[model samples]
Target chain A: SQQGEEDPQALSIQEGENATMNCSYKTSINNLQWYRQNSGRGLVHLILIRSNEREKHSGRLRVTLDTSKKSSSLLITASRAADTASYFCATGSYNQGGKLIFGQGTELSVKP
Target chain B: GAGVSQSPSNKVTEKGKDVELRCDPISGHTALYWYRQSLGQGLEFLIYFQGNSAPDKSGLPSDRFSAERTGGSVSTLTIQRTQQEDSAVYLCASNLEINTGELFFGEGSRLTVL
Candidate 1:
């Protein structure tokens, strides 16, 4: 069973726009991490927000976590064409051997 | 130093045949993981190995899938009697013991079952 499920199966926006994607998980987590995947390549770690933390930022990426709702969101500011990729949210449980269970992911397309 | 590396960037095998995928973790990394991703789908956890202790094989879908890590560095995932459903990109990742939760992924091996 997948622990997390991301909303908005697909998204499209113009360059320089802000893109927001949401993820909902089933259980409590020790931490939640977001990753970006380009076509025919591996995933790249973007940012990680601990359960105790409500929000985190890395460059243009902003992530917020709401443990009460079991949901998280990743926001990309000033999006570019290169930001066009599939974004996934993964949850790591404190008791689950630190394994990350990934969500279905959201495909974002930024057209220049 | 290099990050995780997976051999045979691409592979094509007939259905019912066996295939072996290898992963070379970053030097000194103690935690290694394997995942499978289908086209336009999220990554699915397969198995995990930490040091010389027992591996966490709970994520393996069936008995046909098996993995082994030698000396806690190099790992191999073998799939027997491969089926079309097995076609996907197999990814390997590794992280230092202190931060086992942060994974550095490899380019991945794209497997295509005919």
Candidate 2:
């Protein structure tokens, strides 16, 4: 079963602009993770936010989690054309025997 | 291996036939996972293995879908009597331990059933 649902199935933005994607999940989770996937390739782990933490950053990636609302968002600042890919949110629940449930993903296109 | 590896990057088979997809996780990683991705969709968790024992098999769509991990390093997913609906990219991922936030994924095996 899927635990997360990402909004805005597809997004297109000009290079150097910012891109933001939102994810809403059901049930409590130990952590939430974001991933990037190029066309027809494997997924690359981007950043993870623990349940106790509210916000985290890595390079141009920023993640904010609001456990109170069971929602999280990913922000990519100064997005580059190379950043064009699909982004996904995965949630971890110990009750599920350590399996990660993923969202449908948001397809992002960065145009120069 | 340097990263999680999946073989038969592309496979074409006829309906009613069986197919085997293989995955080799990073060395010493004790956890392995199998997921399916339909075109324009997110990954669907199929199964998880912890040191050759699958504690959670609820994700398996049907009895036709089965997986096994051997030596705690490599795993195989077998689909018996494959159907066209099974045509999708089968992905494998691994992590150092259970409940880890990050997972290492493979390039995935694209399967097409005709």
Candidate 3:
């Protein structure tokens, strides 16, 4: 079953603009991961944020986790056309033996 | 393999037919997974195998879906008595361990039932 729900089912933004996507999950998670899928193909791992971490950054990508709210958000700064893809948030808990429950995903289109 | 590899990138078959999808995870990766994606349902986990032993198969929707891994390296997902609704992309992924977070995915097998 899917545990995460990503807001803004679809998003469109101009190149160099910022893109932000939010995810809310139901149960407690040991960690959360963000993945990007291009052309409905294989998913690429972007980043992983543990339950103890509040925020993390990698390059232009920034992810914030609010365990208190059972929510997380991904922010992309200076987005480019290549950044366009479907993003998914996966929630992982130790109780599940490390299996991840994924969200439906948020489709982002960056127009150049 | 440098990354997860899935065979029969595309499969087309009639209803009631059986289809087999193969997945080769990165060498030494003990964790493997199968997921299904369709128009109606999003990405859904079907099974998870850890070194030839599946500890989690609760995500499998029905008895028609089954999977196995051998030598802790390669895995196969078999769908029996396939229905039109079974048409979807079957994805394979792997990681170093079941407890690890990083998952490497394959290109996925696109199944079309006609």
Q: All candidates' lDDT scores?
A: 0.91, 0.95, 0.91
Worst 10 residues of 2 chain B by lDDT: B93-102
Instruction: Give the docking tier of candidate 3.
Output: medium
Q: Estimate, for each residue in B19-88, the C-alpha lDDT of model 2 and write its tens digit.
A: 9999999998899999999999999999999999998888888999999988888899999999999999
Q: What is the lDDT of candidate 3?
A: 0.91
TM-score of chain A of each: 0.97, 0.98, 0.97
| Residue B72 in model 3: lDDT | 88
- The digit string of per-residue lDDT tens for model 1 on B38-86 reads 9989999998888755346888989999999999899999999999999
Error of 3 at A28 (Å): 0.9
Q: For all the predictions, what are the DockQ values?
A: 0.65, 0.91, 0.75
TM-score top scorer? 2
Give candidate 3 regions above 4 Å deviation.
none
DockQ winner between 1 and 3, please give it: 3
Considering the two chains of model 1, state its CAPRI-style docking category: medium
Q: What are the per-residue Cα lDDT tens digits for candidate 3 across A57-83? A: 999999999999999999999999999
| Candidate number achieving the greatest lDDT relative to the actual structure | 2
The C-alpha stretches of model 1 lying farther than 4 A from their native spots are: none
